[model samples]
Target chain A: GAGVSQSPSNKVTEKGKDVELRCDPISGHTALYWYRQRLGQGLEFLIYFQGNSAPDKSGLPSDRFSAERTGESVSTLTIQRTQQEDSAVYLCASSLGQGLSYEQYFGPGTRLTVT
Target chain B: AQSVTQLDSQVPVFEEAPVELRCNYSSSVSVYLFWYVQYPNQGLQLLLKYLSGSTLVKGINGFEAEFNKSQTSFHLRKPSVHISDTAEYFCAVISVSGGYQKVTFGIGTKLQVIP
Candidate 1:
């Protein structure tokens, strides 16, 4: 079976521009998550989506960061007015359901460089 | 709220030698612990997890972790390591309180297996 996958493995954009990163979770996964990983740092939780429930946006660092998921499939993370600090690896993960017990499958990640 | 701490930033061990990576977490409520490994240029993968029963959890690639509730720790260990074991390891925890499940990750520990 195909594992979770992210598109545009590498993206370079202007600091003021907006960028959208896409993720395709494994088949039948009902929960998805987004995270940011800066060089030499840990994974920073960004947002989570479970089935049709309202997405968990509490981890969003700022109003400029937002994510959307349709049903239980694809998810897109959009960053508005990106800053140099936004440069990092954007990782996407998914699991069988919405709980801590389920194992998360991660995507290769999209490296965004805000120039 | 939950937080994870990885005591060592790096662990260097000779091939075929034992290795240990310490991790500690704090949370007001019950939690689930997990260990993830990330090889260079690849996505993160689950190494092991401790959700319920069985304090000693085994994972892929001859990896294992022991969950110590009293010490609030879940340290990863391997009896012997191979050069291919060189990678970054991250410890994570999710608080299972209220309706939301928020996961926190520790700053990864880089494992350098010297041959």
Candidate 2:
């Protein structure tokens, strides 16, 4: 893809249900990131992936939130037993990783609304 | 731990008016600074970055920011803004941990350019 891409641009799920947001980063990119943007707030770091190394999960708000990436390609963010407060836009980004400028290319985020 | 702060929650300005959005961060070690913009219904786009260079960094759409190490701030500004510039702006910092990069974001500032 020419740019980062995300699936199910909009999602409506009931409280307690699980949701998975997908991200397809640019080809050959070695780093991927996941972030959350609440209404009227800034982007919040969730998780990070660098090649095949263990992901940085320090930003996950709780045990309900998890993310995984395979090799240097697609990534998935799964939220278990979603809460109303979980309503926000989930964004994904990719970068060239170390040895280059750390500018991240973002996708059109998935807006999840838990009713 | 690294953290970021955006002083202003919202700022309104008339078209063609100059504007500045304030951002500050706290870090124990040298870090990479960045500014990102998010238009309505879109994902974030990197505006500029300060990674060991001149303090003044220029970005797309006539945006610029000055990285002040003393004050620990990176403020975004535009000589003149257009209605299209109405969007949410975020400040971020990249900190290296165990050979991997960890990004932290501040509470965003909404720039509303009135027509």
Candidate 3:
């Protein structure tokens, strides 16, 4: 019954610091995804996890971005040495499966600001 | 690869007036189309999706979209809009022909419903 949820509704950090955004997907969901939304821009795919398979990291802009999901439950997105360009809203979504037909339910997102 | 294009960045329409949000996509293979709405300070919500079968798909809040394979388009429309309908609408596509189904989202359209 619960929807996706994310922690730290807002985060402010230094340019060289690292930040971790957490996401709690809906119960029984087997698919989870992370995206970045910059101001005045669209959602950019970051990574995704489906069950026990290897996560898709193709959309990661750099090596600093990494994510991990523990057995189809909670997921965490970590950004190392954050930059001003990485300042944006980090959103998480989950679905029943990896099927193209399944709909994704999104979380409120964590707004990260680098100063 | 798949990509989505939202022609208009913003659309201002009076309440109870018909409105359309244009969306076009390009993909090397067959794809699934979707529309998502985002309210202020909130995450995206699925408005509708076109997986297969009928070309005309209906969604929540009296919204609908027609999938045109020939023109590579999936435009969202509503007979009448409410002031509460003011939000950002996003068009997305996912290719079904391949290994990993990555969703590509458009820049989005900001719909400002004037009362």
The most accurate candidate by DockQ is 2
lDDT (tens digit, per residue) of candidate 2 on B3-114: 9999999999999999999999999888999998888877788899999879999999999999999999999999999999999998999988678997898888889999
- For residue A49, give model 3's deviation from the true position in Å: 1.0
Give i-RMS (Å) per prediction.
Answer: 1.1, 0.9, 1.2
lDDT of 2 at B46: 89
DockQ of each candidate, alpha-carbon based: 0.79, 0.83, 0.79
What TM-scores do the predictions have? 0.97, 0.95, 0.96
The i-RMS of candidate 2 is 0.9
Task: Assess the local accuracy of residue B35 in candidate 2 as a C-alpha lDDT between 0 and 100.
Answer: 93
* Model 1 chain B: worst 10 consecutive residues (lDDT sum): B94-103
Local accuracy by lDDT, each model: 0.92, 0.92, 0.92
Predicted structure 1, TM vs. truth: 0.97
- What digit string (tens of lDDT, one per residue) describes model 3 on residues B2-109? 789999999999999999999999998888899999988778999999998999999999999999999999999999999999999999997743456677899999
Structure candidate 3, residue pairs in collision: none
Clashing pairs for predicted structure model 1, backbone only: none
Q: Chain B TM-score in candidate 1, rounded to 2 decimals?
A: 0.97
lDDT of 1 by residue, A37-109 (tens): 9999999999988788788898899999999998989999999999999999999999887453468899999
